[model samples]
Target: MSEHHEHRHPHGHEEHTQDVRAHRGHGPGRRFARWRHRLRHAVTPHTHDSSDKVDGALESSARGMRALWVSLAVLGVTAAAQAGIVVLSGSVALLGDTVHNAADALTAVPLGVAFVLGRRAASRRFTYGYGRAEDLAGIVIVLTIAASAVFAGWTAVNRLLDPRDMDHVGVVAAAAVVGFLGNEWVARYRIRVGRRIGSAALVADGLHARTDGFTSLAVLLSAAGAAIGWRYADPIVGLLITAAILLVLRDAAGEVFRRVMDAVDPALLGRAEDALRRVRGVREVGELRMRWIGHRLRAEVALVVDADLTVRQAHDIAVDAEHALLHAVPKLTAALVHADPAPAADGPDPHLALAHHMTA
Candidate 1:
């Protein structure tokens, strides 16, 4: 039996070119038709094709970069405000919160660099492009979080050893509120964009921002206790903030590690299998696998087809199956479909010799 392979990189530019030609006709209704087409394309989900995939990847990277810059600006302003309060009130809790905000803002630097690198085209040396840079950025972010936690913990311990009065309690409380508002806003924006773009690193950064917001609230509690004449409350709240940072660090680290290990959701595998099975002329769906390359997904599938079918027929079936998978699986940019001829019911296994040789 012969094996047939269908490798397709779908391109939709021809359709786009035709559309442009159609719009070139000078009729009043032509403008309306063109506008309608544009509206439909904008509102509809994008078809899985090479052109669209490239465009989507670039657009997603641009959006991620924007999110990082906007977050950095907001957090920078918030941290500066909190830093002033820290100096005036000498509140350990406020100081720790400020440190966290500053570290969170700086993390965007590495992520932005990764996004830029991810945009580079695939070369002979790096066949998959620079998408893995995002994973490296994630590691850096994890380390930054760990460092902030240690610094916060040490500062809190030192404060506990030598209790001190905090001045400008009202200003410190106001700064804490500002920090919370800024971090929450940045967190929401980052997480929303990250999920849409399928970026794990961006999502982890968003989680970090959210934890910083909660820690900022802890700073407010410290300010309140100080106002009420509890000298130990500030240091205790600082320690609590440190604990919260550690918790977020664990979560962020786990998420990044999963991405690095190419761990995809099991549901995606099921969906891919179901899509392949639904394709006409597919006798059976064999080994199906998917892995993430940055924010996009790639799949490899083995398909069983009729043994008597011509090579061209089997190839067509494989093409159809690949199209179905691209349509059904979200974020899947490419797929390799291999069609195998099914063995006859009364005949020896076609692959037995190959399997035996491999074992030997």
Candidate 2:
């Protein structure tokens, strides 16, 4: 086989300059670095400029968010009523639902704002854009869920240790039913918003609401049990709800934390790499890396090609490969392809020669 030579084009310098500037502006290539780290950790193969679709999706999300606010308000009022009714009836379970309502109200604020922010254009500072706001908001909601769970658990345990006598069971029972219905409506609205926006945060909020709704049902059942002569059932149900909430808190908090830490789903990376490999002239893919930055998938892939190809040819191949990946991965916001000539299977390492050349 004849050995071929690689030559750099005059415009190569210009392209390198632009790539450097873009990387510098985007925060020290942290996103790219993370992408590389995840790819190195897992090697696998598996798994749109539809702006009109994005716009349509966002519009639907906005409408859902608006409905979410109204539903939350209804839930809050219902919670307040439940609190009064429970206190009058001496029902601790209803009191716990009040705390749940308060958490739901607080999380709704961030979720609504995140939905709007995710659709906004990129600023000079955030070149890749604000799509990650929804992810951050989801993180906030998860943290709140954990905190609320812990507090509720502690309170439930205390109440269980020293049970209180019931007084106005019917009033508290009525309030619990109202709260359950209201939360269910809000939860469904949030779930719809999340599906429309592809927002993990909104989905988390919806799931949180579902948990609360379930909790309310349990409280209602306990109140009914109390009225039917099972005086201890109310506190027992509250304790069980506390335990279930803790488990839910763990899952929500863990997922949100991973997303915030820029954890790329391995399957997504494999799919991207496989797509890039399909491009012609791409001899092999070295370090294929990817990460989620807000709503955009930022990828930095190292492509191996024939060492004999001209610089322009290599550059063109890289560009084509990148475009292919972007088109294939709807979530891909941006990509950086580093073209590296394939090294001989058994030959002198290029690094030593390059280092010597640099010193000379």
Most lDDT-accurate candidate:
1
The candidate that achieves the highest TM-score relative to the unseen native structure: 1
Error of 1 at 190 (Å): 1.1
Root-mean-square deviation (CA) per prediction: 7.3, 11.8
- Clash pairs (backbone) in predicted model 2: 89-168, 132-294
- Residue-level lDDT of model 2, residues 34-83, one tens digit each, is 46534632453211234544554456556657766776787778778877
Location of the lowest summed lDDT over 10 successive residues in candidate 1 = 11-20
With a 3 Å backbone cut-off (N, CA, C), the pairs that clash in candidate 1 are none
Q: How much does candidate 2 score in TM-score?
A: 0.71
TM-score for all models, in order of appearance: 0.84, 0.71
* CA displacement after TM-score superposition, residue 234 of candidate 1 (Å): 1.5
RMSD of 1: 7.3
Query: What's the distance in Å from true for residue 306, model 1?
Result: 0.9
